[model samples]
Structures are given as structure tokens and as C-alpha cells.
Target: MDTLTLKIIFMIGLISSSAIRLPHQQQNKQNTVTDDRKTPLETGLLLLVFFGMLALPLLYVFSPWLNFANYKLPLWANGLGVVSFAIALWLFWRSHQDLGENWSPTLQVRDGHTLITNGIYQSIRHPMYTSIFLWCIAQALLLPNWIAGFAGIIAFSIMYVIRIGNEEQMMMDQFGEEYQTYMQQTKRLIPYIF
Candidate 1:
């Protein structure tokens, strides 16, 4: 098929994979703690970033107003986008699987939460963040519009820079020295290369 068609297909698959995980994540939210560091500002920024990165791009994909299809990169870029998306999905799923009930959509210590250090968590303190970074890269590659293509990376970087310290502080508070030790062993987003 055409390049746009292939790009659309990859985007749809990425969205579908993300959508499928939502219900499962909601079910697990029952284990989350009432007290959380998910401040209103943080939540607002997250929503803004989500809209900019995902929603706006999806809209741009189907609409003419923001269409920059004429600026599309070589077909290999789209292929790379698909590969990045596949890796993101795998990392997202694996991180959730490894975290189990301890996983929270925000910064919170779950009831009976244990510091997870095995599986994908063994090397990356935030595999979910890594997965998201992958998504940003894929989005940049797949979307032709300048705003839609790069918004994810910009927004995600803002959120990550602002939130990671707080997240680690919360973990350290909850797990004490254990979390500190885990932090020493793991990088934030990359394995052996952060």
C-alpha cells in the first residue's frame, strides 16, 4: 500500500495496544493508595502532554488542516517507527506485568507494595518511561506535521524532568534503604547506557 496507509496502520496498532492495557490498569488501581503525589499541576501537565502527543497527532493524521504528508520522510523512517512502536508496546506490557499490583498510574505507594527489582525492572527504574520515550520517537517518525511529530518528545521530556525526582523521593520514603539500593543498581530509563 501507500506510505500514508502504512503509517496509519502502525499508528492504529500502537493506539490499540495502549487502549487494551487501560482496562487492565484500571482493575489494578484498586490496589493503589489513597494518598498520592499526583498533584493537580502534575495531572494537568500530563493531560496536556497526552493531548498534544497522542490526540493532536491522531487528529492530524486524518485531517487536512494539519496534514504535512508532503514532508514525509523516506519509507524506512516509517519502518523504524513501527519497530519503535513494537518495542514500546513490549516494554509497556512487560513493565506492567513485572510490577503487578504495585503499579500505579501516578506516584503512589500501593497497599502491600514491594520494591520490584526483577524482570525488566532489574536494569531500568522506569521501564514505563522508557516505553513512553520510545512512543515519542515513533510518533516523531510516523507523523509528518512538525507540531504533531515532535510534541510528544518535548512534552514527555518536561514531565519526566519535573516528575522523576518526586517519584524517586516517594519510592525512597516508602521503601527506605531498599529503594536506595535499587536506585543504585538501576538507571532511570536505559539499561547500562543511561
Candidate 2:
């Protein structure tokens, strides 16, 4: 792989790892506690979303039409998507770094997990998800394949819908008045415009 690719991966790994420093602490209810683990059905839905994202690129490669041979993406679209993806990755890294040990994929809180209101959090309540959502849509736009494009949109939509509910509930419980005030100031997905 190229150096740029390696650097991106390293950045992503470092951020993700740092954000998830204390998974066990997050699950300990004595913290900002909640029992919001997904139901079996929700878990299945989440798995479908995860696998769909993973499979779409592979399917595109082997697709008989070679991702719609006639529907090549414009060079500008490809360039924009690549750049958007890179930006989304950077945003994810920033959000993750800001989150630090407070991050948890599930609806659990860590000890001393103060509400973060600076950096990306100052604008949107969920910058990491925002970036991922943008990246997913950009992938579809850039790929110019009906299957890949729609799959990414649908898959991410499904994941976000489920994720936001659980996340908000937990945050509301943990941060209480503080989170409520933050929510009033910031949009869920978009910044000031939304």
C-alpha cells in the first residue's frame, strides 16, 4: 500500500483505539449507567448494515456489468468523492480524538465521561456519525454503480436510524440537563444549516 493509505489507516486506528480505551468501564452501570443493549432483532439489523457495507465493494468488483460499464463516473465526481471521503476520515479522526475514552459503540458511558462541547461537538452533536454518513453517500455518488450507490445509502440509513435512537437515549440519561441544552444548540446530523 502507498504511504498516504498507510497514514490514513494509522490515523484511523489511533483514533478508534484511543476513543475505546475503557470498554469495560463504559459497560459498568455504576458509571452513567444504562442497559440499552440492542435486542436480538436490532443486533441482526446492525449486522446486516455492517456486512452490506463490507460486501458492496466486493460485489461491485465481480458484478457482471463491472459496476455499470456504460455508467462511468465523471472524473470530477470521482475526485470529489475521494476528497470527501478523505475529509470525512479526517473528521472522524478529530471527533474520535475529542471523544477520547468517552466513546462507546454501544449505549454505555465511562467513568468521568464529561460531556464534550468543543471542537466538532460544538457544531453537531454527532460529528463521527455525520462524517460516516457523508462518506457513505459520497461513495455511492462516486461509484456510479446503481447497486453500490443504493446499497451504501440504504445500509447507512438503516444503521444510523437504529444507532441514533440508542445513542440519544443514553446521552440524555447521562448528560441530562447538559445534553438537553446542547441538543437545543446543535443539530443532530447537520451543523447550523440543518
Candidate maximizing TM-score: 1
lDDT of each: 0.81, 0.65
Tens digits of lDDT, candidate 1, 68-127: 543667878878888898898889889888888888877777678888999999999999
Residue pairs with colliding backbones in model 1 are none
The residue pairs that clash in candidate 2, if any, are: none
Backbone clashes counted, model 1? 0
lDDT of 1 at 106: 76
TM-score for candidate 1, please give it.
0.91
**Off by more than 4 A, model 2:** 1-36, 62-70
Worst 10 residues of 1 by lDDT: 1-10
Q: What RMSD does each model have against the real structure?
A: 1.9, 5.5
Candidate 1: deviation at residue 140, Å? 0.8
